[model samples]
Target: MEIKIKNLTKIYKNIKVLDNVSLEIHNGVFGLLGENGAGKTTLMEIISTLLPFDDGEIEVAGLNVKKEPLKVCEILGYLPQKFDFFPKVTLEESFDYLCKLKGMNNSESRKQEINLRLQEVGLLSEQKKYIQELSGGMKQRFGIAQALIGNPKIILIDEPTVGLDPHERISFRNLITRISRDKIILLSTHIVQDIASTCKNLMVLQKGKVNYFGSTIDLINKVRGKVWLYNILDDEIPHVDLFVSLQDKGSSIEIRYIADNPLQGSISTEPTLEDAYIYINRKELTV
Candidate 1:
C-alpha cells in the first residue's frame, strides 16, 4: 500500500504544527525521526484520519482520507505511544475481543487467524497470560498483534520503545522489522539508534518542517568529514564546544565531537546517525 500526503497543514491557535508537509510512503518501514513537538504526532494523526487538516490532502491506497475517511480507516492500523487494555483479560481473550470489535465474526477461521497473528508477534505462547502479567516488550507486541487483525495495508506505530529496557528495545525493533514486509509501517521515534537499526528510509522533522528526508545512509553522509574524536583529561571537558559524547577511560575521556575545522591532536572520525541528526538540526537553527 502507498500513502500520499500532499501539502498537508494543521493549525493550532495561530501556529501551524504541520506546515505544508508532503510525503509519499510505500511498503516497508518508514521512520519519522524528531523530538517531541516537532510535529511528528500531528502529521501522523492527520494521516491516520484521527485529526482534521486545514489544507492539502492525504490518500491511502488511492482513497482520500478526508473524502473517504471510513474507507481509509478500514485499511489503517495505529498503535499510539500509550494504550491500555483490560488488565484482567488474557492475551487470547483480548485479541478475540478486539477482533470482534473490528467486525470479525466468532468463527473458526477468525479464531485461526487470531492464532496466526499472535504467533507472528511471538506472543502465542503467552496467549493464556493476563495483560498485567506480560512484560513491557510483550505488551507492545500484543499491541502490534491487535493492529494486525485485518492485515491492514498500513500500520502507524508511535514511539513504541520509549520505556523499554535495552534488551526489550532491541527485541521490539526486531519485531517491527520482521513484520514490516509487504506493508507500509510508519514508525515515529526520537531515538536515533531505533531509526538507524530498523528503518532504511527516514524523515527528520524540525519545527513542523522536513529538514531531511531520504535514505538513512545519505543522511549519515551529510556530516561525514566533519566529525572528530579527541582524548582529553577531565580538566579539559569544560573547554570543548561541540562535544557529542564521551567515553570514560582509566585516566582520560574519549570525546566524539563535530566542528567546522579540525582540532589539534584530534583524530577525524566517521559520522554516526546521532551526529548527522545533531548536525542537521544545528544547521537548520543557525540558518
Candidate 2:
C-alpha cells in the first residue's frame, strides 16, 4: 500500500497549520518527528480523512481521502493522541462493538481476533475491566486494540507512548514494531529516542515545512565531525553557545559541542538522530 500527499494545505482562520506539505509513504514504520504545533498532527488528520484540508490532494491505497472518505476509513486505522471511550464499557465489549462496525460476521472469529489483539498489547488479562477502572497505560493499550479491529492495511499512531512509564513504553514500542511488518505504520512523536530506535526512515518537520526527510543514518551524517565530546566538572563547564549536554555521569559530564577547531582533551563523538534534529531545527530557526 502507498499514500501520496501532494501540496496539502490547511488553515485555521489566519494561522496556517500545514503549508503545501507533500510526501509519499510506503509499507514500513515511518516516523514523523516534530515539536508541538509543528503541523504533524494536522497532516495526519488530513491524510486520515478526519479533518478536511483547504487545498491539495491526498490518496491512500489509490483512493482519494477527500472524495472517498468511506473507502479510506475502511482500510485505515487511526489512534489519535488522545481518545475517549464509554466509561462503563468493558474491554471485550468495546472491541466487539468496533469489530461489528467493521463488518465482521462470524462472532466466534471476531472474538478470537479480539482476544489475540488484546494479548498482543498485553491487555488480555484486563478484558473484563471497565474503561474507567483501568490504569492509563492499560487504557492506551485498549485504544490500540480497538484500532486493530478490522486488520487495517494502514495504521496511523500519534504519540503512542505519551504518558506511559519506561516499562510500558518499551512494551508498546515492541508491539508496534512487531505488527509493522505487514502494514504501513505511520508514527508521529516528539520522543526522539522512539524515532531513533523504532523507525527505519524519518521526516523532520519545522515551522510546517519538511526540514529533513530520509534515512536516520543520513540525517545523523549531516553533522558528522561537528559533534564533539568533552568531560568536565559540573562547575568548570565551558560556556559554549552550540553545546548540548547528552548526559551527566556524576563527576564527569559528557557533552556535545559544535566548534570549527578541535578542543584539547575532547574526543569526537558520532551524531545521533536527536543531535541531527536539534542541529537542523536550530539552523532553520536562526536563519
Best by TM-score: 1
Give the residue spans of candidate 1 off by over 4 A: 238-241, 283-287
Candidate 1: pairs in clash: none
lDDT at residue 181 of model 2 (Cα atoms): 85
lDDT of 1 by residue, 1-287 (tens): 68988988899989999888888888999999998899998888888889998999888999999999988888989888865588999998888888887778867867997899999988888999999999888888888888888899899999999889999899889999998989999999999999999888999999999998889899999988888888888655644546578788879988787887867988988898999998888732221
Query: What are the candidates' C-alpha RMSDs?
Result: 2.5, 2.6
lDDT of 2 by residue, 102-198 (tens): 8988999998998888988888988898888987788777877787878899999999899889988888888788989879999999899889888
- Report how far residue 53 has shifted in candidate 1, in Å: 1.1
- Best candidate, lDDT: 1
